[model samples]
Target chain A: MKFEIMRDRLLDGLNDVTKAISSKTTIPILTGIKIDVTDNGVLLTGSDADITIQTFIPAEENGDQIINIIETGSIVLQARMFNEIVRKLPTNDVEIEVENEFQTHIRSGKTEFHLIGSDASEYPLLPKIDDENKFEIPADLLKAVIRETVFAVATSESRPVLTGVNWIIENDELICVATDSHRLARRKVKLENLPTDVDSIVIPGKSLNELNKILDETSNPVQIIMSNQQILFKTDHVLFFSRLLEGNYPDTSRLIPTEFKTNITLDGKTLLQAIDRASLVAREDRNNVVRFETLEDNAVKISSNSPEIGKVEEQIPVHSIDGDELVISFSAKYMMEALKAIDGQGQEVIVQFTGAMRPFILRQVNDDSILQLILPVRTY
Target chain B: MKFEIMRDRLLDGLNDVTKAISSKTTIPILTGIKIDVTDNGVLLTGSDADITIQTFIPAEENGDQIINIIETGSIVLQARMFNEIVRKLPTNDVEIEVENEFQTHIRSGKTEFHLIGSDASEYPLLPKIDDENKFEIPADLLKAVIRETVFAVATSESRPVLTGVNWIIENDELICVATDSHRLARRKVKLENLPTDVDSIVIPGKSLNELNKILDETSNPVQIIMSNQQILFKTDHVLFFSRLLEGNYPDTSRLIPTEFKTNITLDGKTLLQAIDRASLVAREDRNNVVRFETLEDNAVKISSNSPEIGKVEEQIPVHSIDGDELVISFSAKYMMEALKAIDGQGQEVIVQFTGAMRPFILRQVNDDSILQLILPVRTY
Candidate 1:
């Protein structure tokens, strides 16, 4: 294989695929990035058994030639070293050639490097998915949905299914939910071109996090294909594949409280800042719990006390307070993360309480599509 | 202690002193910052036993009232927590008051925190250094001196003194040297106001590193006073004290070879980049050794080889090569750091080589104040 390509264009492709490569993988060959050169374009693939990422660089982009092909072949090189070399190359143009016995030569400006390459045939083939079951979502919307719910997934692997976000599609509505038993986040979106064959899938939070980072905020459409064991997210030039978690996700529909004993609407930014200060002392405690109490004249107090670290209290005036006066305690970290995910800053959020021991839900004042629920700590 | 000070002003004082605070210290009290409120201003001090930093925020600066002192007293608060609280306070003006039983009240806007403060009398006292044995150096120059030599200090505690930079002052000349047996960096400056009594001292590299971060790149004079056991660096608003390493510094003067068999002058940046690329492969080897050999027509080749990782070679042209042809190998990391310290980019640097096994020295073509020496590795 021999080709001369623009250093920057090749570097972009390497960066995208390398996100899925792990040097610590037990499968030694998985640590190598497979490169295939053809008359059409160049493809780079990286995988770590659980996730695979492949990016393509076309021979020509727009009116400029991105790659000049001299021959067509394949080889796998050490992903880490190759990426670093390309990044530090001096000139914009780089020439790569695979000589006899898989000896790869990379040359740019006055610098040259020779790396031992493995036969690309040894790389695991990408899982094949019959394109019959696929759906399209705007990249930006998918990123937002992932951000809103992924953090709530359980980090512990005791229940592997809970470590993933559950995606359910029915009646032209796409609902994503993530929970760690202690707290839950749910986001609902209406889909126009919903595929009937695609019903429910569980994607690991780690995969969604990586996919979100790779997706741009552009409204470009991303086609998602689902197989029984693997899911693939395909963009214009990149394909990300993640293995689906096995097992059934818990039914969380009934866990959300529909009735409330007290309700309060307040500026989310103000409440978030106050809770942040309270957490300064609350974080010293095992539960990181902070107390919330309604005061007179549409005001509420946030306080936390650690016997050894002292106490903190802050008062914030709310827009309105209705129903019964209440006091509740919950983890400040959970509240903060939920508020941020909702983009609560500069917006009004309504909190509904269903007694001190029950779970409460928070959502934007007028938006019904997103909900954040947290189980209150048994502290007064 | 009661005072209403601008949050930003107080934060600046906290930041400067907190550089000396380390929670890992065995002395628990050292993790707290001592704040003393007097009629003149507020003083903040933090110590980690080996080093102490104190910053003063005056009541008035240039006719502007920065602090409103309501009462005069002192208290010690957890450095990390207090710094975080002050940083996140909402209002510009913050009120701090000491109530009964060492309960410190910090109030800003609608937020209030009562922290458990400790007795200030229990904090360690700052070392006393007499002003009679003192000299002055520009803050920016001192910072530069530290940067040039500090990285060469031995990190291992086998010879504790080698972990510090040795300073020698005589005949208005200030010379600082640091080495780890394999490589050495030396910088010299001519001082205008030299103190005869202060002949030599060794300041811990860690202390100098912290001091460098706190010192601004300004021409403001820094008064450096040397004592039997401690050295004090006093600025207008901050006082930094560092305990000196007690030991004799080995004489490195004879280690630098004046006679050379080969001499070459080249653009420092070009050579540095070539060496950097070579190090990419060299780093995989235990010694991180890169080979340099003179080539035809004033060109030199930089290369490194790791049997398991392949090889890298680059050729850099020189401005002049007047001496005999030579080949040598050295640590690429040491060479790159030395070049950066000398501000080698966009400047001509002269390299003098005595032989393949002897140490080589690099310096600016016309400047003799800074010299970097690297011992050659036996790799032929």
Candidate 2:
């Protein structure tokens, strides 16, 4: 393969695909990135057996020549070295040429590198999936959904299905739920073009994290297609494919409380700071729990203590409070995560609780697109 | 101890002294920072046995009030946690109040923390040294001298004295030298005040590194005092002490060749880039070595290769070349460090060598303030 492309444009495309490349992969070939050149431009592919990322550089961008193609071929080169070389090249454009075998030469300015390449046929092919259920969503909205729920997924491998986020679609409403049994996060949004019937799929949290990183901040639309076992996300000139986790996801609908005896509204920033201070002392223990006690209708007591690390207590002002006085303890990290996911101009959030042991829910006053739930710790 | 101090000013002072604190120290008290409140102001000290840093926070700076002391006492607190808490406190001012025992209460904003403070008497005392040999140098210039030579010190601890920088005072010139046997760096400066007789001392590389980090980018002069076994650096409000290495530093005066058969001058940035590109391939090997070959009178070739990785070659333009054509190889990391220490805008550096197996010297035209030497590696 012989072709020349702009250094910056090629670096961008290479970076997007490199997110899937694992340096410590058991399969040696999986550590290399496959490059293919054609009349269309160049395509770079990297995969780690679980997810595959492919990015294409077009021949022209904004009516300017980005790639001047002389020949068309394919080869696989070491991902880590290739990326570093491209980034440090001292020129605006890079020329790559592959010879009879798999020896590829890259030239830019006065610098030239001859890299040992592998046969492109050695790379595992991406899983083939029929476009059965396909829908479109704004890239930013999808990124927000992933960010809100993905962090709550179980990180342990004991329960593989629990390590994935559950996506459910019904009547054009898109619901994403993630839980680790200790805590849960759920977000719902109305879809522009929802799938016909009721559908549910579990995508790994790690895959969503990689996808979120590649999604830009633009308002571009992303088309998603799913088969029985795999899902494909296409945006601009890039394609991301992730394998679905097998088995049924737990029924989290029953875990979220439907009623509440007490509700408290407080500024999210103030509560976050109080919890952060408390966590400095609480995180030393096994449970890492922080207690929230309501003294008056407009004030809440936040306190945490550890046998070895001393104790912390603070009074946080609240906008409004009602019903029975409550003192509940839960994971400080979980509460912090839930608070960070709430993004709005107003700093107040309404927290609803059914009982001391029951899972509580947190939501913004006027915005209901996001929801956070935390299971209280039993500290008798 | 009871006092209210401006949070930002106190944090800044603590940061300077905290550089000597080590989290992995075997001595428990070394991990704690000693705070002594006097009528004048507050003094904070942190030490890791090998190096001690003490900084005084005055009652006021410029026109801003810093410390308001109500009681005079001393206490020791965990260095790491105290620094972090002070940095993230949610107030402009912080109040620290201690009871009869060692229970300390720190209040900022609405948050309060009860910490278990230790007795300041338990902490190790910093060494006190008085030396007749003293000199002053610009803070920036002293920082530069340390940066240039410290990197060449032996990091492996195989050679005890080689792990320190040799400071020699002769006539009115202060010279610093460091060598790990493979590479050497030397820096010289003219001083107004010097002892009548010549003197030499070896300070630990790690100590110099921490001292450099603590030095601000001001034009204030730093006083250097040297004794038989210890060296002290005193600033206006900070005092730093470093123990001298016991063994005699090797005499390297004969290692640098005064006459050379080959010489070349090249732009530092251009050579840096060429060496960087060559490093990409060389780093795959055990030594990470790159080779340089002079061509004719105005060009040089840089190259590196690994059997499993690939090969990289680049041409670096030179300002001038004389004597004979030569080829040499050395660690790319060493060359990069040497290039970074030479400060100037588009300056040409003269590199001289006597033979392929001997140490080569690098310097700027008519400037003896800085000199770098690298030992060649045998390629065969």
Candidate 3:
């Protein structure tokens, strides 16, 4: 196999696929990236057994010749070394050729590299999914949904299912939820094209994080297909596949409180900054807890006390306070993260407190699409 | 004590002094920053026993009132926490007051913090240095000298003296040298006014690193005073004191060879890029060895080989190659760093090779102010 391609075009394809390659994979061949040069384009594939990524570079892009193919074949080279070499190549044009016994030669400018390549036949086959059960969504919207909910997924593996974000689609509405039990993030979006058979699936938070990074903010459509065990997100030039968690996700619909004893509307940024200061002292405690109390004149007092360190209190004015006077304590980190996520949408945030011992919900003042719930700590 | 000072001005002082404060210090008081409110200004000091930094913020600067001092006293607060609180305060002006029981109150806008302060009298006293043994150098030049040599200092503490940079002053010339025995970096500058009694001193690499970060790139004069056990660096508003290492530095004067068999001149940036690419494959080897061989017509071949992985070779053009043809191998990392340091000054670099086993020297083509030496590895 021999081909000369534009260096930047090849580099872009390599960067996209290399994200799925892992050096820690037990399957040795999984650490290698597979390259196939066909008549139309060049395809690159990388996998780590759980996730696979494939990117393709067409021979011609916008009437510009991107690749000149002398022959067509396949080979798998070390992903990391190959990527680094391509990144540092001096010239814009690179030539790659595969000799007898899979000896791959890469040249650019006056620099040349000879890497021992493995036979492409040894690579594991990627799981196949039918395109019949697929739905399309804008790339930016999907990215936003992932960002709003992915951070709440449990990091620990004690309960394996909780390490993923649960996705449910029904009645043309798609809901994404992530919870570590202490806090939960939920985002719902209305969709026109829905897959009827796909009811629910739990995708590892790690997968969504990688996908979010790869997905551009453009409004281009991304087609998603779901199989029995594998899910694939297909963009214009790249295909991303991730394996689904085996266990059933816990039902979190009932965990959110609908009734509230007190409600307050305040600027998300102001409260975020105040809690950040209070957290300076509370961070020394095991729970990182801070107290919040409603006051007269549409204001709230936020404070944290540590006998060994000191105490901090800040009075933040709110837009309005109604229902009842209340005091509650919760993890400052949880509150801060929730406030940050809400602050991304709008400045005004409405916080509803059920009681001192129950969970509280924080959402945009007029938008119910995104909700952040935090369980209070009994600091008394 | 009570004072209201501009938040940014106080933050600048805190940032400078906090470089010396370490929470891991065995002496608890060393972890706290001592603040003294005097009629003239506010003094902030932080010390980790080995090094101390003090910065003063005057009451007025450029005819603007920077601080309003209501009273005068002193107290010690936790360095890390206080710095964070000040960084996040909302208002431009911050009020600090200490009560009779050492209860420190910090207020800005609607936020307030009460920290448990300690008596400043318990802080260790800084050693006094005589002004008779002092010299002044431009801050930018000093920072450049440190950057060029500090990276070559030995990181291992087995030979404590080698972990420091040796500064020698003689006949109005200041010479700085650092080496880990395998590689060495030396820089020299001529000065008009020099101290007569001060001969040589070894300053810890760690101390120089911190001082380099604190020093800004300006032509302002920095006064350096050498004492028996401590060295003081005095700037306009900051005083930095560091303890000297107690040991004799080895004489590296004889290690640098004046005679050479092969000389090659090349662009520093081009060689650096080529070496960076070659190191991609050589990095896996124990010594990170890359081979350099002179070619006909003022060209050289740079190559690295790892039997298990691959091989890389690049031909780099040079302006001229004089003397006998030579083949030598050295650590790619050392060569790259030396080239980078030289690239900071000029693009033209002259490389002198004595033999295959002898150390080689690299320096600017027309300047002798800085020199780098690297010992070759025996591959055969």
Candidate 4:
């Protein structure tokens, strides 16, 4: 492969693809970035068996020449060293050439680096994900959904399926839910202009995090294509492909209670701050458990006690409270995270609970698209 | 302590002392911060066996009443939890009352924390350091000296004495030197209006790092009291005490060669950048070694080659070269660090070499107050 590419463009591509390249991967070839010079542009691919990321640099972008391809060829270079070389190459323009023996030469301004490359054929071929079940979502919207729901996914692999965020699409609406049995986060968004059949896919939480990282600062629409086993998110110049988990995601629709005897609207930030203060002592305990109680006259209390350490009690003023006088205990960390995930959307959180033993729900005051729920612990 | 202290003032004091509180300390009480409310002010002390940091909050400062003394008492509270509580308190003024039973109640706004406090009598007492050998230095200058020399201290504990920085005081001048045998860093400064006999002290590098962190933003003069077994640094509000190393520091004067067969002056930033780029390839090698050669003209070349990887060669333009043609190899990491420490002094680096295998010297151009030496490797 021979090409002269813009430094910033190549650096951006390298950083994007590098997210998928893992140093601990067992496959030796997966540790390298596959570079191919094509007629349209130069394609850089990085994969770690679980996810694959590819970024393309066209011959020209935004009326500026981005890459001038001299020949069409491919080579896999060590991702980390290659990334460092391209980023610190001391020039605005970079020229790369691969010899017949897989020797890659990268030159920029006053610096040049030659790297030993591997044959591209040694890399595992990425599975083809047909566009049969394709959809479109604004990059920012998808990023927001992932940010709002991915944090609740179970980090433990005991259940395996709970480590992923389940995506369900029906009637041009998309809903993503992630739960760790103790707490859950769900977000829904209406799709636009794409006609597709109902589908369900569980994507690993880690892959969603990488997708969110790459989508940062870009507002372009992202085209998503789902095959039987793989899902692809194609952004402006990047294609991110992640393998779908093979399992039945536990049905969570029946988990959220629709009928609530109590509903309290509270300032999201104030309650978050109160819980935060209580957690100062709660963290010393293994469970990080804090108790919340509804008070009279639009007031509530949050407290945590640790016998060896101390106890913290905070009173938070709410906008309105009409809930059956209740006392519930749950993880202070979980509640804080859920509140923060929905706190800054220009709305307070409306909390609803059936009783102290059932799972409680927190919804944005006026927004019905996002909901977070937590099961109370038996701390009596 | 039973007092109402300004949250900001108390927070600052807590942060200062918390630096010396190590969670992993063997002494159980060392994980707690001792709070003493006296007639003059409230003093907070935190110590691990090696270092103790005490910060005092006066009852009043600059016409502002910072603390309202309700009663005089002492208690030891868990450092980590107390620090977090004070920082996250919900009021400008914090009211802390210690019950007779060692139960402490911290009240701020509508939030309160009750912590099980330990008896202050269990905490280690601060050492008594006589002013017999005391001097003062500007905090900024001392901080700069520490930053320049601490990085060169030996990390390996094989030679315990080399793991500390040796401070030599004589003729109203203070000299600090640190070396790991492979490279050495020395910095010196003249004292003003301070009379003291010649003295030398060796302080652990880790203690110096902690001292640097506490001196992060303040620029006041700091009083230094050197006792037989301890050194005390007293600022306006914080008193930092560190145990001194007992063994004698090595005499390193004979290691720096005075005669030079080659002398080259180069821009510090440029040389640093070239070396940094070269290190990207050299890092994979066990030694992280890079080669430096003096060119015929006003130029120098830095290159590193990895057999499995490729080689990188860069010619760094120098201001002047007046020495025998020379080639030497040294640890790129050490050279980069030394160059960086000397780079931002608004001056270039003057390199002096005795021979290919001799210890070479790097000094700030036109300034002899600071000097760095590196021993060359016999690379075949």
What CA RMSD would you report for each candidate? 1.1, 1.6, 1.6, 1.9
Taking the tens digit of each residue's C-alpha lDDT, what string does model 2 give over B151-204?
999998888999999998888888899999988999999989887543888999
Give the alpha carbon lDDT tens digit for every residue of A1-380 in model 3: 99999999999999999999999999988889999999998999999888899999999989988999999999999899899989999999999999987999999999999999999999999987988889999999999899889999999999999999999997989999999999999999999889889799999999999999899999999999997799999999999999999888999999999989999999898899999999999998888999999999999999999998999999999999989899999999999988877763338999999889999999999899999999999976
lDDT of 2 by residue, A1-380 (tens): 89999999989988999999988799999899999898988999999989999999988888989999999999999999999999999998899999979999999998999998999998998888777678998899889999999999999999999999999987879899999998889999998778764389999999999999999977799999987689899999899999999999998888888789999988888888888888888887888899999887499999998776678898988989978889899999999999988763346798998879888999897787889999999999
Sort by lDDT, best first.
1, 3, 2, 4
Query: Of the candidates shown, which would achieve the greatest lDDT relative to the real structure?
Result: 1
Best by TM-score: 1
**Model 3: per-residue lDDT, tens digit, B309-335?**
889999999999989989999999999
Query: Candidate 1 — number of clashing residue pairs?
Result: 0
Location of the lowest summed lDDT over 10 successive residues in candidate 2 chain B: B339-348
lDDT against the true structure, each candidate: 0.94, 0.89, 0.93, 0.88
**Model 2: CAPRI class:** medium
User: All models, DockQ values?
Assistant: 0.89, 0.75, 0.86, 0.77
Name the candidate, 1 or 2, with the larger TM-score value.
1
Error of 4 at A180 (Å): 1.7
Q: What TM-score would you report for chain A in candidate 3? A: 0.97
Candidate 4 lDDT score relative to the true structure: 0.88
What's the C-alpha lDDT at position A194 in model 2? 81
Better of 3 and 4 by DockQ: 3
